[model samples]
Target: MKYITKNKKNNKQPRTAGEKKIKTMDPALLQVRPAMQESAGFEATLAFSDMPVHQLLKQNIQNKGYRYPTEIQERAIPALLKGADIIGIAATGTGKTGAFLIPFIEQLLHNKNRTGLVVVPTRELAQQVAEEFKALTTGMKFRAACFIGGTNVNADIARAGAKNHLIIATPGRLLDLVNRKALHLNAIEVLILDEFDRMLDMGFINDVTTIASLTRARRQTLLFSATINASQQTLIRQLVQDPLTINVSSGKSASSTVEQNVLEVAPNENKMEVLFNLLSGDSFEKVMLFAETKRTVDNINKQLARRGVRSDVIHGNKSQHYRTKAIQQFKTGHTRVLIATDVASRGLDVQNVTHVINYQLPQTMEAYIHRIGRTGRAGKKGIAYTFIN
Candidate 1:
């Protein structure tokens, strides 16, 4: 084995090892270069500004203090407005929901009595989309409902019946609603699948296909995912027609905005110390922490409690009421920290989250992106910190 040697006082390694002894370099000879260009982080850009529909929609955005469109929003919104099927590949927090929602709302506003369907991978996301739709469509008469697990199915159906022109639902519950004859998809003109890749990863492909078949054949479809690689081609082909694919790199591994760092610690004891240090600082107002298992979620919550820090936990093992309560608490600022497995962290809709801490590294880089996305949502500046070893 041979090692490359560099001259003293200068850090550059010569192109050839023989060059080291050939020249006496000046003091100013050292020139350093990075392997890649330093990232300025992802910034939001407006893609649909001057269009008449967006100009009408811009008033709602400006009133909310959202001056710029995120990358996903910039790219996905125009295709949606053009009546083109969209396949959006963007990071978790790049305002994807709005990218699809704003145009859907505008279309619905133009054609009354026609409904839209948004299928999400999780209950949290279903609720989040419903809330965002409600917020953005304020003062408008359009009604929206959320059909997800844990809530009263009867109530969701009633809400759907009363005035819902748009419904955000999870696959299982939505299928259940369809089976019970409580909902009809034939009237739905717009169909959206948010976080479609996660739904496939969760084994919802069959359910999604079945649900899609229920809609009318001429319906407009929109699909959003963190990555739209070849693996998703079949699903993509089945749902969308001649789709306009927009790949905005917003996944966990690629986000330039988040300064990702991993902390090395012992198996269990050092975890709290790392968390406390990150949280005790006044700079971060909201933090989302991820664990690999539900048991870890409980244990970490207990640890935080003992440390006199108020935290909430949500996972598959928790009851629906508990999960909903935890989310509500976190959203209202009653709890600054929410601890859970990937279930709670992914597809969670909380804006202005300043930081995301991975108590454990996920199995893949994509999961890391989705977990961190909860913080840097809607083009807001945020950070993600991870713990390793």
Candidate 2:
């Protein structure tokens, strides 16, 4: 890739930096590339049947077409089955959901009445966890309630009263239901916070804490996040007891399979036009454009639509129905591009995404990683570009 700079033009890959503050328009910083390294490794001697889980779970695993356990699943399932508190750090698409679900399902099979709760950062994530739980417990007699915002409160209340073995919920709606006496979590045996750090990022820490406190009988607390900040040390301690930290992705990094680069927007150049020209390329199929705010996403969607490009937008401002429909349209290839704010960074999972473009630089590196991770999933080669204007 070539870059245009104020001083001169070049075709060099920029050196990676360790900046405390981002320098978005630095001419010397032409491209931002992630250092490639093996994520992590473990002895994979056990198959689904070899693990000491129920036969039904083995069958379910096979039915899902999961041939082998990912690193997190392999390391977490054993300890979790023993009812141990754990802090799991793995990248996106590493099977973190299955790691917790498989063991917890085994726990449910042994004792049918015991209930568990999974708290996530987004409504979409809560829905996904519930769906994963359903798939894992296909033949088993397990029941679950999913409570999220942008849905009918009365419906969640009715479902909450139905003797469920598990509850998957987003923190705000979950806590609201608890305060309204619609949901009872006092006797819950296990509590899981998926995308744990993202909850902190979204300012849902207090809500999650209150929900965790309400689940007073939680014997095992499982925390999973793709990236962990050292500043969250105190919060992590409060969540888990004598926790085992598992770093399957080693530390903070983007996917190795993603080809990371940057686009230089010259002082006089029109960035929107530059993006339009880039997307016009034959290689730019099925792209995700990440903008800083809802208004920006919507503007981009409008611009793309006017230029005869099929696209959809999702953000916190959109209702659940709108966001769900937008994602479905993008996922099904009905839309060639999906424009989004940070809300879709964690929970949005679409397969075979050809490219991810950061129209605006993310506030933090962790957010950047989550944004690019939407592509390069399931061991597929993908591309990510950050536009430097």
List the lowest-lDDT window of 10 residues for candidate 2: 11-20
Residue runs of model 2 more than 4 Å from their true location after superposition:
1-32, 35-43
Colliding residue pairs in candidate 2? none
TM-score of each: 0.83, 0.90
Candidate 1 lDDT tens digits, 267-325: 43444666776789897788888877777778789978898888989998888888888
lDDT of 2 by residue, 197-311 (tens): 9998889878878888899888999999889889889988888879999988854877787777777666666667778878999998899999876777888899889999999
TM-score of 2: 0.90
Give Cα distance to truth, residue 320, candidate 1, Å: 3.6
